[model samples]
Target chain A: MKKLILLSLIILSVFCSCSIKTPEEYYKEKEKGKYTATISINCETAVKYKNSKRKKSEILNNYKVSYNKGDTVFTALKNACKANKIQFEYTGAGDSVYIEGIDYLYEFDCGKHSGWEYSVNGVFPSVGCNAYKLKNGDVIKWLYTCDLGKDIGAVK
Target chain B: MFKNFNPIALFIYFVYVLFISVFSFNPIILTAGILGAVFYCLFTLEKKSVFKLFGFCAFMFLIITLTNPLFSHNGRTVLFFINDNRVTFEALVYGAVLGLAVIEVLIWFKCFSTIFDSERIIFLFGKISPKTALVLSMTLRFIPNFVSNFKSINTTQRLIGSDSRIKRYLNSFSAVITQSLENSVITSDSMKSRGYGLKGRTFYSRFRFSTRDIVFIIISTVLFALSIIGRTDFVFYPSIDAPSLSGFSIIGCFSFSALSLIPFIYELKEGIRWKYSISKI
Candidate 1:
């Protein structure tokens, strides 16, 4: 009985050591908000892919996020993701920031014509996400399209 | 095992395994590759040294897997976040696979060096280009020779009660480099005097293709073709999914395992046969 108890304790300690540690909070809540914007991310078209990572059509609903002046749509998305713990990945830098993947769905994942695109106030800008500066109370919606923005109602 | 097969057969086997290990990202293939490399290394190299090599490879594998997600955040299943960057499970798996492929190739090269000595190298490459063969053989020979020479020089200096440890290494390294340069000049001169690289030059090699070699080559070629045809299409970004195991892929996996284990199986069979013959005697 004593040996059994000792063995169980050792095994319990091993399990404890091997178990993954809960990751600490990464982003701190901002103290002040100079401006606020509304953002939403959806991958409705990803339903076509059988093995997609999307759990639902809407990955992130309209979340209100605060940002400073000169913040781009990309910055707003990044901050919102950080605050909400949503996984977001992007390539390029500054005004050229291109959202490569979000919530595990990446570009060209569904098909060659599939990718992530965003529109501000129902207007899809010609420039990249980081280049499009966010205005106060701006409405930004990110959509995943299977046909290169054609399915998401974004022109060329 | 080396004595049982012709140099060409061994060369082709190495190429087949190396090609598969490099191109395939599937976990099944990589695991098979690691197992085969470990077993083959055990057969060729000292058991102690094999363990040490594998220990180092395992350490490197762990380091790559853990550190890969820190720089790239392109996976769906978020394990946790590090400084606002998402450490996804996908990137970690990708890194692990990448590391495995790297160490697999490295161990196979270790097997390559053990199997292909200077004689086999020349025998394999001599028919195409004699000059290149000579250069290749000489260079391959020089690396081990240089290390041994450095060790002897370092030991002599140690006996002489030389300077600091670092100083001894630098001195030995310099001495080895100079000696290698002089040795290369002499080798080139000796080859020139021997009329090497001349047209219609006949080379001597003991390696002869036997029926055994033909059988081994055919088996290896067939396995190689199967592996290529049934290769895995694993996607690592945005999310991780189970490897789609089609009929061809399952066959490919089996063929790959067989291909990698060929050397070990041959060695084991030969060992058992020798034991049986001795028991009869």
Candidate 2:
């Protein structure tokens, strides 16, 4: 009984440690079935900087993805990037994961105020991407803004 | 050579080198600073101490360079995945640059400590704030004194046949702490008796602003200005930005290298002059 209790505790801790599941694992488990979403990554505002390393404005246009009920915009974006083989990088984890860069363009690359920002259904959520949960048929757009969302028309 | 220069000149030289080492991330600038510092250390410090310093710096550099990729996962050109996190070439480069910057700054500081001894420190700050200068000098002097004091205490304990290792160390540490506290009180009392912070106090110093010092100061200031004006911007995240060798950046690197080597150059000139004078005699 003591051995069984220790094993259960270890299993519980393992689950707790990895509470933030990858999209593939979430799809495999399908705890609340699945819902479809679309995500696009663009560096439209980077055009203002002539010397920027932006390959193209449209990185991934209207890319479709699937996620579970509790999945966030970040999860959908991650799934889309993985499927399309597009490079993605972020810092922190869970609800605090900041999308640092996509396609080699990082924060402060173009200018001081330049960085990656995300919007859901045409509304820019002030919170981090991982913190903003996604609904079914949601449209997620990851934009590289050179002016802190002002030039991207994301400010409201 | 260092002693002949005015305290202000030596102070300015050290400050400029430290500022450049700490602020600039350009590869050329960093490499130049490291080479200059290592060369200066070779000239000034004993071989054994230099080797020890280099060995410790290398260990620290490797630890920082390796551990950075494990934590920072933001970069292109993924090498592999450790626990599903991408370790990239850019992060590795960034970490190595960071490690070099830290080591370079530390070496420059070591050089500073060798030249800017307690007497020079007192001379520099004594006029403006005598109390602060006294405290700073005393604090700086206390560290090595504490080490020697502990060693003597430990030896005395050993002579009296205290054989347990843990007990010996613990006893010596406690004794050192108490002794330091007592010494601080005595030192303060002595200073008070001497009227140390009294106004209208006159200080005697051998340093003077000579023609050679004026020339040295001008050269260092010009080099420092050139380095600041021509410093290159570098990016090492998401993707490693290749260090551009633009004309301005090359100028910056050259001037910075020259600035860092001033001390070594001075020492060499002095050594050559001494040899020539001996031969002539």
Candidate 3:
């Protein structure tokens, strides 16, 4: 019981830090359930004009994955990409993960504003995708926002 | 008599120096902070403690600097590739700067902790809030008291010559905890009889603001302002360039040096004054 309290305190401290966004911070309160999320890479419009040689099917256009406890949206995306044999490139090992590319279409490939962004249930989470904890029935859409996330309707 | 200076002035001066040391990452500025701290420690700290501080700081510096380039692959001029990640020249230099900053902050804090005693802390906090002052003073005293109590208990148990060293240590520790609790009860009862935490309580302050204190405070405050102006335009990634002494940065550099050296300067001044006065006599 004492060890459990200590562990929870450590978890709380990790979550409280504002260095980068974590998904658990996106929710109003902690919720427990099995979750399903969908991920897609949308570098098609950007890649089509820029590089015609790269195949559109090379990108993970659509994939669905279920999340367990302590699972994040980034993990879901990672699992989906791995299972489907789609190339997914990300940097950072922990909660501060940055998704840099999907398939052959990497960041700065299309334009200066092009990068990966994620939305859960139509609302973009304020925290990083890696930090966002998944809840039951969470719907995730991973898109390539070409105009600093403005094209994808992300607020931050 | 506290090196013939007011506690408030001394506290404020240390605060300014610590603030600058914590924030500034320029190598030259960090070097100055380290030098000032070393000078002060050489004069003030025991010989053993001074050596220990230097050794510990150097060890930490090397560890922090060496590991940084391995993990962070930032900078343009790659020195060599270790496991495909380029160990850039800029990253190594950046790591050194960070390591130096850490060392500077630690040594400066050591000086601050040694100089400012519980009396000074209580006097500083006692002015505005008496309850907080009492708590602060008690917390400060508790550590030393606990240490001394533990030592005495350990010695007493060892003298009895009963059990093994580990068992004796465990017994002493348990005794120390119980004794400390008992001591607190006795202490509170005595304080109650003496009317601690009562209305209209008067405090005896030994610290007096002299002309030197006023001048010192003013100068330190000015130095702090100047140091901020001399901010280094420093970035550690993609490429590395030494922060050139821009006109504004020069002011900051000078101010930071002066602020950091205040304690050393005071001691030097006092030494000179003593020698000159004796010569006159």
Candidate 4:
């Protein structure tokens, strides 16, 4: 009986030592905020492939994005596309973003006329195209050819 | 009687062992846990098999340590250099630590498997249709049989000149799947023919909860609670910035490890009693 009591005490002590704080409590301690936005993608270079000679029409519609504090730029872009109801495909090697079957070839290109710039922690890169870490309020833009001109929507 | 060899206690201890091994940073705690597992296996398992397992774990540990530095490059302290590449002291230590953790986890899992043998499966989940239970039991039983069967199938395939790497892989995979499906069908037929779940099925277990079980359960539960509480607010990292010895911390870590050994001690006591009774007879 005495042995049993001692063993019970040990078990209780170990259990109490390892208890984890709830996720809500952790976030409250960290003080994070959430953001939502829309990301648009247009494919301009797609040619007629199947039983048609006319140029393929490109569209970038229905992008929805949401992210919390400390989310990376890639994650933010993904969340934004999901929130805006836009269909997008990721090129697996982390180069180029595609929307509605239209590939945005210039987003990853660093040459002049690429019309894309990347910044990390408010500092622009000197050379080479690399992933830029994102901060709050940082904006990412992609310019693609569209026949219908630009469309804009707000995210809450 | 095997005093205090309760399945519930063994399950709780197994969980606690895994928890401590993953969380505890102190090398002493980790080493003690590894040694305790080895000792427990020695006390319970056949000697030759346990020795073979120990040798395999040692070989695996060496291979992991040698290969881990190729991928993970973290840690500040560089111990040596191979050409332009640096072999950090941290990588070797980390690999050994991970290897030990894996072996310890496997040992704890083995204990759980032994404690909750087929009989306990029937007792706890007997209400689950006999068809389902029988399928699960057969699946568990078929793993070893499948491995041996695959080896024989591969040898025959090699003899038949169908031994290209791709062909071997495809043939072996298809063979195992076909055999497993056949085994499952046979098991189901046998179970149904025996009227497995006609009306209700009865189960027999060699386990019962005595006073010892109650005491063991209470103690293990309490220890689990305490370990969780101790870990929650405590910041061990960043403080572990260096590998300096602190005697008090060492003692504290070992004490926790020793706490995990309660079930093993209980089993040892049971073994001793059984031996004594047999001798007297």
RMSD of each: 7.4, 6.2, 11.9, 19.8
Please list the C-alpha lDDT of all candidates, in the order they appear: 0.85, 0.83, 0.75, 0.55
Q: DockQ (C-alpha) of model 2?
A: 0.16
Error of 2 at B97 (Å): 1.8
Between candidates 2 and 4, which one is better according to DockQ? Answer: 2
Residue pairs whose backbone atoms clash in candidate 3: A22-A131, A23-A131, A23-A132, A23-A133, B76-B238
RMSD of 3: 11.9
- Per-residue accuracy of model 1 over A66-86 as CA lDDT, tens digit each: 989898898899888877777
User: Whole-model lDDT, candidate 1?
Assistant: 0.85
**Where does model 4 exceed 4 Å of error?**
A1-156, B1-4, B81-85, B128-135, B149-177, B193-202, B232-255, B274-281
Ranking by TM-score: 2, 1, 3, 4
Q: Which candidate leads the pack in TM-score?
A: 2
lDDT of 2: 0.83
lDDT of 3 by residue, B129-199 (tens): 86687777777778889999999889988898958999999999999999989987897788778876677
lDDT for residue B1 in candidate 3, whole number 0-100? 26
Error of 2 at A76 (Å): 2.0
Runs in model 2 deviating more than 4 A are: A1-35, A45-55, A68-70, A107-117, A122-128, A131-136, A144-155, B158-167, B277-281
lDDT score for residue B17 of model 2: 87
Cand. 1 TM to true fold: 0.79
Candidate with better DockQ, 1 vs 2: 1
Docking class of 3: incorrect
| Candidate 1 Cα outliers beyond 4 Å, as residue runs | A1-32, A38-64, A69-73, A83-85, A91-99, A107-156
Error of 1 at A55 (Å): 12
Q: Which has the greatest DockQ?
A: 1
